[model samples]
Target: MAQESSSVLARPFSALTLQQAWRKTNENPEITKADVALERSPRQEADIFVGNLIDERHGGPITIGYGRYARGQSLTEAMAVDDVMIVLEERLSVSTEAGTVSAGPGEIVYMPKGETVTIRSHEEGAFTAYVTYPPERPAHL
Candidate 1:
């Protein structure tokens, strides 16, 4: 996985098991409200916990991962990258100055680049799989 991630190698190892992927993230549930308070990144604090189960940020054009947000947590910030989030559990809401939208399990939400928006979890919290473009940020950022 490390080799493929760093060099963009096409080693499509499809034999990976679900358990391995879960273990990669230590099967973590959430990042806890206490931890969220301790964190300072406005862009992702409300995202709770994120896992790079199949990290593609080393050199790939896009990266994949999963994230969990505890109930009532929210993040409002200008997006630094484009994101496509697929809801895996519960519900999610993305709000912009223009309006707001909500999606439930099995639904998808997309937030474009440079847009300032608020993302939050609903009553039951949220779990999602996501893809982000331009895997690595420019150094000046």
Candidate 2:
């Protein structure tokens, strides 16, 4: 049997305001890796870079992570929890089982639990987004 792919769920908020906030706080913003349970191969190039703002390990039920996708890179998966994503810079193309949508700077996108989605960045530049989702415990644990 083929293994199912892991997805990210997210709802986007205003990108402009968030970008401004990031600029103002860029000097020393707290960032960490997202704590989602997924398998990734070391040989695979890291197309997505994530910095966590809040997570379960930090004593929070909601997980908030900032992500940057390199140009031409795409991430596709089915989420295990509800998610929200806010575009911070450039543009991102989001595709779901229902349809595909394009979000630019300051736009927000929402993805429900168990929904399969694909996110990609344009070749002109990298795409940045803030993603948030409820903490989920892996079934194996």
Per-residue lDDT of 55-131 in model 2, one digit per residue for the tens? Answer: 67777877666666777877776767776777767777778755567776666667778787877778754445444
Candidate number achieving the greatest lDDT relative to the actual structure: 2
lDDT of 1 by residue, 1-141 (tens): 112121111122222452354345454544222222222222344537665433353455675666778899898867678877776677877877666777775565677887787778888888776667766243111
Worst 10 residues of 1 by lDDT: 1-10
RMSD of 1: 10.7
The global C-alpha lDDT for each of the candidates, from Candidate 1 onward, is: 0.58, 0.59
Give the winner by TM-score.
Answer: 2
Q: Each model's number of backbone clashes?
A: 0, 15
